[model samples]
Target chain A: MNVNQVVQSIREKVAEGISEVYFVACGGSLVDMYPSKYFLDSEAKKLVAGLYTANEFVHALPKRLGAQSVVIVCSHGGNTPESVAAAQTAKEHGAHTIGLTHNKEAALLNYSDYSFLYEWGDDSNVKNNPMAIILDLAVQLLHVVEGYAHVEAFQKGLESINGIINQGKKQVAPRARVFADKYRNEELYYILTSGASYGHAYGFAICSLMEMQWLNAAAIHSGEYFHGPFEVTDKETPFILMMNEGRTRALDERAQTFLNQYAEKVEVIDAKELGIGTIADEVVEFFNPVLFYSIICVYREALAEVRNHPLETRRYMGKVAY
Target chain B: MNVNQVVQSIREKVAEGISEVYFVACGGSLVDMYPSKYFLDSEAKKLVAGLYTANEFVHALPKRLGAQSVVIVCSHGGNTPESVAAAQTAKEHGAHTIGLTHNKEAALLNYSDYSFLYEWGDDSNVKNNPMAIILDLAVQLLHVVEGYAHVEAFQKGLESINGIINQGKKQVAPRARVFADKYRNEELYYILTSGASYGHAYGFAICSLMEMQWLNAAAIHSGEYFHGPFEVTDKETPFILMMNEGRTRALDERAQTFLNQYAEKVEVIDAKELGIGTIADEVVEFFNPVLFYSIICVYREALAEVRNHPLETRRYMGKVAY
Candidate 1:
């Protein structure tokens, strides 16, 4: 089913008395939940939202998770143990569990009250990707339940996201190649961003750079950069700053101005220059992650090619068991 | 004022109508706010809580901030600009503002509806530290507003914390020295923990290690270890694992087991062994940050002694303008 159809079905089921929405997942999937959670937190009048790692959510279950709650759990492959367990726990509490995954037959589906299958390998259906779908759900839910006014603009923005992402990929290619070449031998890189773009930067740092490329990387919030992490800035240090056109853009720009002066290498990926400027300013921030995901994928691909390491290459992730 | 008295004042002022709580701060102070926010998130049935860096809090003000909201802003020295702005914004929104600081005369106080001064140089008053004070406020508010049952036990535990910390300091000295010696020359270190202890680990990595010592470090959540970070672990990797005896202890243990096998230098600081076990099991996790804070201060001091790099020696923090 399309994302709107999925949201329509969800709206028809638990739209009356829902008070809480939980975005629970793990790893990259957990990061993917951030934008939607951020959206709800910023816009929802009566709905309280939470974003949690599935394991922590299971261990420290919120006291309010009952029939009034709608818990959304996401796993890329639909088989993350913690995600499955979180769904089951939410189910036991009588909260409606919405499971999102790329796989058709997922364990999460069995425990979920509703399941949405997102496109995995299909580039043509960029809007059907897990992050995009979850975000669409959040937008639709907010609009349906609380009369969020920007729903139409959000959907229109999403419709143009594929084109925006394609343009972003092309626009970022030259810089991505340059960054890969320049930082090819560097042992550590810090990925910094704020607001909605933070999650994508986190995914890029951990999943793409550290896990896939075997490079030391950390994702730092731009707003939190001045607090303590800024002390690490020096002539030898390198940084990747993800800039988004959003309410927290000033935070990113502040960090950027500092990084340009202190850090020798600062690779910036600005959403405004990546076609996000064409989007309605009100709803553009919500799409920052989608655009960022595409741009960073280009970066990781370039880095992988330059480093002669495939993105799937792993040493201990699946080969050895703890 | 004494913590309970401060909480009493807070309870009397806005306790009747509070529906949302925002914990706003920066750097180590931001980490300090995590425990209370976590406590509220786990225990409070009606109050929605948010933990944010002060800048983000100011920039993306929650739409729910109003007369029914309580904003807790903390700045150790009481002059963090973003924190002051957050307090001001909260006041503008007609939210009840509670400012926590060590300084008696602070800008934050001007914007706050109520203010609590914590002890900075007074080691005898550990219970009046910012984290302890905010946590006490949370506990009392929970009890007064929602009738949280463990308030007395939490207070008793707070009274015993000073002695527990002193004992923990002596107990951890030998291991701290060993860890400092083993990783004295290391260029990069990763601090890992889960649940309530994660914030303390984050403080140790960014504030104590990176900001103070000018070392490269990243704090990884133990629950997130297997996700992408574990791939960076190998025989040469050095790690400082902060383990707390909490609901998420299993997550920390799982990461510790993997780190012990794959990483050469795994420095484990167990709260259970650090006198946290003496506290009531029901309230132990809430105090993990307090225990971990003292233990890591020992680790950082030992590191500074071994490296002959004074913790106050900063190249850019306050010496140069960003």
Candidate 2:
């Protein structure tokens, strides 16, 4: 079934009452689920939503998880042990479980009530990527259960996201190349963003920069920048700022203004310049994360080339028993 | 009234209903409130709790912050503009608002339905510190509204906490001095902890290390270590691991084992060795944060002395426009 039809089926089964939705996974998979949680938190007035690391979710299983809860678990290959255990725990607690992965024969699929396959490494099928599919599940559930008015706009967004991502990657390639050359020798980086766009900066910082390149990086939330993190900003500090074109845009702009004044090396990446304007205004923010993620992938590739370090190089992951 | 009586009064006033509680502040104040949120999430079966940065709380106010909500705002000197604005926003939404600060004349007190003062710079009155008082509010409310059985033990903990903290400082002083000497030249550090103890590591990393000393640091959650972050762990990496004696202790231990195997400069400060054992086992976890926070203050002070950098030194915090 399609993402919408699978969500519709779950909605029909839980028609009597549904109070909560949980998104749980690890690393990039956990980061991919944030936009869906952000969408639900922003749109649903009554439904509760939570995003957690898979092990934390399993260790502290919410008392509210029951027949009225929908737990969404994801792993790219559907082989993360903690994520599989979380799905099994959710099932044991009688919560409806939905699993997203590229592998159909994985243990996560066996434990979940509904399994949805998303495309992996397929540039032509961006809509079927894990991030897009999980977000669609949220969009569909909110539309069916809580009467979302932007369903049409959201659907249009899904249809045109691949073209928008391609445009974004092409537009940002020159800047990405410059970033790679300039910061090639730098040891640490700080990626800043906020709201629905936070996960993209986070996944790129951890998965691409830290894990792949063996460099130090941290994702600093733009809204929280003025609090304590801004003190670390100076003329030599390297910062990558992700700006959104939504309600939290003012927060991002405020941080941008500060960074421009105090820091010399600030890379400003904005969703408005990435063809999100082609999408309907009502649902543009929901598409911002995928655009940011796709363009940042180009940045990662550029860095990998300049540093002579492959994106898949690992020191501990899958190499040692960590 | 005392902290317990203030909470009791709020409980009586909101006898009709209270479904959610939000803890909002900035910097160290925000970090200080996480244990209370963690306590509510771990103990309460029906009460919903959220911890957010003050600006985010004001900008993206939760839809559930209405008549059936309790919003708690904290600022050390009570002059943080965002936190005061959050209290006003909560009041405008008809929620029961509680404000904690050291200043009774602050604007936060004016906007809040109830104001409680916590002692500052008074080691003799450690029980009345901001973290302890805010946590007491949660404990008292839970006992009154939801019938917590650990009330007596929790009260005993509050009474004896100051003594425990003094003893803890004495116990960890030598280790703190050694840490200062070893990392006096280091420019970046990562503080790691999990569960209720997470706030201590976070507050220390941001407020003390970054904001005060102008060093770069990030608080890494221990449960999330195995995902993407463990790749950066090496024999030369400086890590401060805070161990807990709570339900999430196993997660901390797992990370501790990995850090021991891979990292050489790990400083392990545990709750069990710091006199938390004197408190009742049922109520011990809630005190872990305050213990961690207090001892870490010693470490920060030691580092400040050895590095010749005052903890009050800042380039942009209060010197210029944000």
Candidate 3:
């Protein structure tokens, strides 16, 4: 993929004075865009970023989404009805729309001004991760809009992501096996994280556990955990805390301390502990979600193996007419 | 509470050139601010509003939050530590800070440039609802900044909130009792809603069910429900559907159809069924959450009574040191 070509196209639109960027998608794809949205909010000086569920985007029809807006819609199969509708709605409102998906022939492409396709197969591989693609788009936009200084570091981190995933796979396999064996019969679990990792926690809980494995789960941000969620914690309550190297580390640490004091079935995945292959300190926070995602994939595989359930096992997703 | 006085105070700040509005809070208060934040995003022509968890706001302080910013912090007790810290941080950054709480002597007041107290007791009254207060602030800010035209309709709805709540309570009581009796032993539930009602579903699931009653629940937005959450639903899944009068009603209707076909334990509270007390149709969506909250309070009471679990039962919060 030519990153510069994509960046230059967005730059032309930015030069025309865009006010905001909207990342619209559904489910895992929506979760995939959150870290990118976070980066845009944190780094962009000229444009603001908003994350919206595709169906809600069509119904809510944000007032700011007009000629001076950029909307990016993501769907792995590109056939998600709400996502296609959102892209069409955004285009109808005169906003520049971009579609990112693995299916080149997806209907979403027909409505988008620009469409990019990544390679994916029946096997779930990390090479075509939507999160990485969205993050690249966000960095490029920020680079052109605000002369973002950390583009080089971001690229370097992206290049090292595969190596980080490989290392994480090796380190997490045994731990994941143990955890899966211990909690395979558990009915519900809570995944906790803060900052960029929160997105991964949410995606894993809903997409991997709830959807794929048919388990019950909820993802709570550490910053909001003490407020009400902490009341649900007990000695046997299962929780997985993704502690990443970010500004919100203290918030996670505070929650971890309390959880450790009470919950016996607590699992911690610290990004610093699972090294990210010699990435720069300044960019670690920006890349924490990527690292967490890689680690979580390995954990998911181990859990699937132990529970005798394949990661692709789904009872209602594509089976019923919901 | 004089809404006009509050509006005038916020207007003076608007005249001073505010750039963005930050809604900062934790858990229930944070959920309460979501609808107001949505209104600010949708209606405020010249201003942007960002929602942040209190601790995250203090740590990842947005670059836009200096000098020309307005930060609104909400805490029912007026003594939440993270909320107090967030107010102080915003004030230190030269942002105009406002604190909304029910306690006048709460420490958050010391760090706020302006503070408003409401009367909230064990009765769960709508008069002092934080959501109503925050919505008023958002509308007033838009009124002064962008000459918003919906201020009158919004105020009319606010004036009729108590009546709406009373009518909703009366209609929801027997149904709530029946549903509670049916599912009091259920371990987990999924509350689904869309658009404006999404915030109330989330707040009720977390605050009233998870925190107050120590129940396992997850609130999924109808827009994103089909993406993954639908896979977790079966013939016996306990789910609550909040069907309110709004643009997103179609979204909720779709989900209700699916749930009714598949899930046996489905309880729906349709706001349109229980009227909003003569409010204008244009502004009814804005008041749906308030009506849902009132109905849910009665549902909580009914559930609490059936299970012999009082609303105030606490195991961890405010009981033991973290």
Candidate 4:
């Protein structure tokens, strides 16, 4: 997987003129693109970016996605029907489409104008992680349009991603073990976070917990928790809080304070406590989600082990005709 | 409330070359702004629109939110600390701030550049509904910016909202009662929808079920459900589907077909069956969410009654110090 070549090809499209960028994918892929979407929205100088589930993208066919649009489709298997269809739709709308997958022969590659095949892995290794690749692509696009300096810091942070993941695994093991044991019998759990880590909270809740383990879980943004979800808190209620080193840390701190007062079973996965600060000071906010994802992956595995549910176990996901 | 006057004041601000619009609120109020946010993004020709939870809005402080920004803040009680702080922050950033609330004497009014007070009630009557008011305001801004014809169709539909509400109530009651009876003892539920009605599913699950009724529920977008949440469905799992007459109807239909094959406890609230078509044909997509909200409100009431709970009963929301 030549990332530079992929970035160069996307840069050429940007040179031609792309007024907007759409990150289109399904499920885990959609979740993978979210951090990139947030990064592009905040960093891109001239391009407007939006995130959409592949099916909805095909249905709504956003008015802004036209000749000057750049659509990025992501699928680990590269054969997700909705994603392939979304790429086809983007082409029909005269948008430049790019597909990112681990399988070169996947169906999504057939429709994308440009396709990049990377490596997929088990729970341990972090190389060529889909989320990291998407984030890097987003930053590279901004680097092409905006400037190299603005993204230089992020690029530097990306260099240490493998180390960060290893560190996260080490730091999260004990906590994950404790949490898995403590809440083994709990039928439902709420995962809470804010800002850059919100996407991880959402993705982990739905993909890892609900889909993979068939556990009942909901992810609530810390900022929105006080609004209504706080009502669910009680002396025995269980919550997992992902505290990131970002602008919205105060929101998570606020939630932590409240949860501490009411809930006895509260698990906190603070990026700072996990030594995220040692990676890079300036770009820590952008990397917090990546760290959180790495940690939660370990947490998921631990929970799966304790609950006697394999992470790959699924009743209906790809086995059925849905 | 004089909606026309509110329109007039916002129109004058639009004439001053508004660059962006921020719909800032929290909880149910945040959910109320989603349809408006969608409308603004799709309809506002020259203006950019973004939705942010109140705390996140203040924390992120988007670079685009300056003198040319129009920030609309909503708080049912008009005293929500985060919302009030968001409005104050918007004002400090030189953006034109508007606050919508049920109490004129509330603290939000003090920081808002303009304020509108409307009647609030128990979940039955749709008259002056918070979501409706916000949608109307968003359409009014679009009307001011890009001629009147596109919005006139929506305005016409708005006039018949009360009738639509009445129709929805009658149509959903029997199904709501049946669903409430069948799922009364279920420990958790999954609510699914797409497009405009997505917000209703989200709001109903959080505000009505989690907050008011103290039930566990998660809202999943129909388009995204197949990606991950489909794994949770079985012969015994309970799900509430909001099928709307909109562009995303096919997505919901697809989910319905899948759920029907696997889940025995699927309760669907279809807007087409609710007579949303007879009232207005041209803008039924825009009215679909309002219709769904109304129907779900009745469903929530039915569920509350069957579960021996009251809608206004809160364990911590307004009673806690968080």
**After aligning candidate 4 to the native by TM-score, how far in Å is the CA of A279 from where it should be?**
4.6
Q: What's the true lDDT of residue B165 in model 1?
A: 87
Which number leads on TM-score?
1
Question: For residues A1-322, what per-residue lDDT tens digits would candidate 3 score against the true structure?
Answer: 3556866776676656667889999999999898988887666656788899998889888887887788999999999999999999999998888899988889999998887786553244443577887888888877776677888988888888767767777898899989888888887889999887787888988898988888888888999888888888888789999987868889889989999898999989988788863787666777888778778877788788888989898877878786
Question: Which of candidates 3 and 4 reaches a greater TM-score?
Answer: 3
Which pairs of residues collide in candidate 3?
none
Scored by DockQ, the top model is 1
Residue-level error in angstroms, candidate 2, position A95: 1.5
Query: What would the per-residue lDDT of candidate 3 be over residues B120-219, giving only the tens digit for each residue?
Result: 7446557567888888888887776677777788888888888877877888888999989999898788889988778778788788988998888888
Q: What docking tier does model 2 reach?
A: medium
CAPRI quality level assigned to candidate 3 from its DockQ score: medium
TM-score of 4: 0.94
Give me the candidate number with maximum lDDT: 1
Models ranked on lDDT: 1, 2, 3, 4
Task: Find the 10 residues in a row with the least total lDDT in model 2 chain B.
Answer: B117-126
TM-score of chain A of each: 0.96, 0.97, 0.95, 0.94
Can you write out model 1's per-residue Cα lDDT over A172-275, one digit (the tens) per residue? 88988998998888889899998877887778877998899888888899999898989989888889888989898999999999988888888888998877
Which segments of model 1 are wrong by more than 4 Å?
A1-16, B1-16
Backbone clashes for every candidate come to 0, 0, 0, 0
lDDT of candidate 2 over B1-322, digit per residue (tens): 7777777777777767677788999988988899998888767766777887877778767666788788999998888998999999999999988899888788899888888887787354678788888898888777666778888998999898888889999999999999999999988888888888887787887789888888988777887777788888988778999988766778788888898889998999998888788889887888889889888989999999999999888888889987
Candidate 2 C-alpha error for residue A36, in Å: 2.3
Interface RMSD of each: 1.1, 1.6, 1.3, 1.7
